[model samples]
Target: MSRGLLFRLVAIVVVSLVFPLAFTAYGLYSGARVERLALEERERQMQRVLGEVSAGLREINSGGKNGDALDREVRGVLNRTLAGYPGIRGGVFLPETQRTVIGGELKWYDYRPEVWPKEGRELFRERDPVIREALDTGEAVTRRIVMYRGEGLVHALPVTVGGEKAVAWAEEVLQPAIGQDRVLRKWAFLLTTMGFLVALASALYISGSLGRGVNRIKNGLEQLKRDLSYRLPPMPGELGQIVAAINQLAQGLMEKERLEEQLQRSARLAALGHLTAGVAHEMRNPLGIIRGTAQIMAQEYNHVPGLAEDVAVILEQADRQNRVIRELLDFARPAPPLMQEINLNAILESVLSFSRKFLEQNQVNLVTQLSPDLPQVQADGEKIKQVFLNLLLNAVEAMPTGGTITIETLATPDGVAVSFGDTGPGISPEARSHLFDPFYTTKSDGTGLGLAICHQIVTMHGGNIEVETGDRGSVFRVSLPRSPERRDAGGTLDPGD
Candidate 1:
């Protein structure tokens, strides 16, 4: 399976964390190794210096030397040996008399001039432990200590001085690598901490961003399950592309479902057309004959009061039946429209003028918002007027007591549009679905062919009729193309085709 965004995000975080840790580990390891090696080399150098001083002390000639001469000779040996090494100082400690002797010319000594001991007994008292350890053990003892001039190494070796036990000790200031290593360790720790924190912050930020994007996608998918019309919002990088693809897929699915519904509607309408044609042919002749007979009887029996009333009822019923037949025929085989360029606003104004008295009688207030720059469309003015009139009457009937009907004409991208909005109880979802279907009417006395015919006429003219309804009211919009292409020699266009 392909890796998901979660996996990629985790991988990114892991890699981000690993790099700094690896770098820190390597830095610490390399730094410690270098520091250790430098320290070991310094210790070796101090050992060599101490070894040379020890040999030089053994070579000192004290056959007839008095105490002052021996002291001067030993001081000369220490100064000569220590002078050979920069930043090195040496001293001898006699555990028997507790006397310490330091080279006077060695400026690298830890003590200041004021702190320097004038009494030999008080000098090098701190070295007593190390010197005694070396004299007792009869072996060299070495120690590393921090001094005034950085880190230094001190070595004490047991020796026989004037046939008495003593400790010859040497001290040397280590190379500056020891101090540099300390600084390096401090900086490395600080830098590693900072790097780790930065990595953690970056990981959290990236993960949060990715998580939000993924959550959006997830929520979008859930919405799609409930509503195919739902579209994914814009995102960045590859996520944006994914959202675009998903939106396209949703659009395609909606189109496919729309086409399927249209196909079903077309098939049903075709069957109804065939049935309507047969029924209208059968009922038309009978309806005409009945009306003719009723008219003759009424003329002959007017002097008979009750007879005339009965004949009038028969004539009215016949006329109503004939109108029904006529409607069916019109629906079954409608004549093609005479397509021409016409202003929709002019047609709407004409329809409004013709229907004003009827609307006033029904107690409906009329409102108009016709766009001055509305475009003309290719349509039949008379048929378009009929459609608008039917919609207006339907709106008036919807509000039984009284309501407002707003008529609007506006310019669309491809053509002109006219809408009729009415303040009445809206069409239900179930009724709305079949509003344009044959013989489906909400009115008690309606033939249910008015809006269906309107839909058919508009469709023939390469136009569309749509409705939007809510609890507040309903709005019916008719959109006609500016220049519709004639589909056949008869100038008829089938929207489905």
Candidate 2:
């Protein structure tokens, strides 16, 4: 795994855990905060209820109301105060006469002893310290209260009825905070789950993307290692740049290998040329002397019985030796091509005309598909013609019993392409490897310089020659530059046989 991918996965995992937990923690804190605020609001509502009750008691005392009329007025005041604030569930008034006046929505709970706490009912019935403190100090007091049904806030205020202490109280019952907590918990879980799922999916997607990029690069390297010709597909972003670099490296390696092979071949050819130069020089004089001696003997012994055949044999062998020596000399030191613009189709026609009789005698079929608009190539006319002739003769010879030789000419993007396809036994892989090597031959009587010379001529013209062989046949493709400018643009040429 790549470091970047590993780090991203780790980050994703951390976020998946940390963010959700943080959200839950925030929810818990917020829930507590909200409950506190709600409790405070309830306390304020209780205070408001207490304030209204105290004002009503003061008015009743000031008006000198008494008995049933006073009780009715007090009850009406408590009811009106509690009704003004919905949170104030109940209100109780402890008058100087010791009669209790209670009002509000939770008044029924006071009668229902099962749900109401005994201590809470006692506090409302009798004067508790919270109420006593308010009555004794003539001040307001507030307390938080919890019972069976829910929680509440109680407010007690001292009311002076003509300077006599009376307690005015209000209790606000709040909805259960547990329900709010449960809601918060439910939301927290939902949010955390959603956050974690999103994090996991994002992490997988990012990790897989990085892994795929790395794998593609790895696979490309492996392919190039197996076959230098392998090319990478186009990619995007930094990976694309990396892939481009790898492809370039592969290209460089391939070019280097080709150059090394060419250097080795050139070295061998140079050494062979030097050796053949000396050997051919040494053998030529002897071969000429032998031929001259045989001719003299033939002339001197023309009347000698059975001497004619022997002299003829000597002459034939010397001629063969001279041909071999000439081929060597040609291979050792080839003359520079006399560059000129020449029509390749015209030259092919002429060579074909000359080879017609030879091809016919060998029972070989010759087929030419010469292009009509074949562009002229900047090359030595005689050298290019010799290349064509050598290729045709090879094809003719390969098909000993008889086969077809297909010659095709067509225009190419960079130049012109000439293909010579022969229906013959394909060259063996082992022989094909060293087919252009000096003195390498498949035939016993071959000089082996034929294809080498052809390769030489094409190379001098700044062109390429490639051969494809299989069980069916072999195709020799020759690509030549369209003009001198095209050839010269390709830089220097390789010196060859």
Candidate 2, residue 41: CA error in Å?
19
Worst 10 residues of 2 by lDDT: 488-497
Each model's lDDT comes to: 0.77, 0.76
Residue 4 C-alpha lDDT in model 2: 77
Residue-wise C-alpha lDDT for candidate 1, range 375-447, written one tens digit per residue? 7788889989889998998999999998999999889899988899999999987798789877898778899
Candidate 1 global CA lDDT score: 0.77
lDDT of 2 by residue, 393-497 (tens): 889878989999999999888778899999999888678767777678889988888887777668768887778887888999989987644332111222342
Candidate 2 lands at a TM-score of 0.56
Instruction: Return the clash pairs for model 2, or none.
Output: none
Off by over 4 Å in 1: 1-175, 182-199, 222-230, 258-263, 289-318, 360-365, 397-404, 423-433, 468-473, 488-497
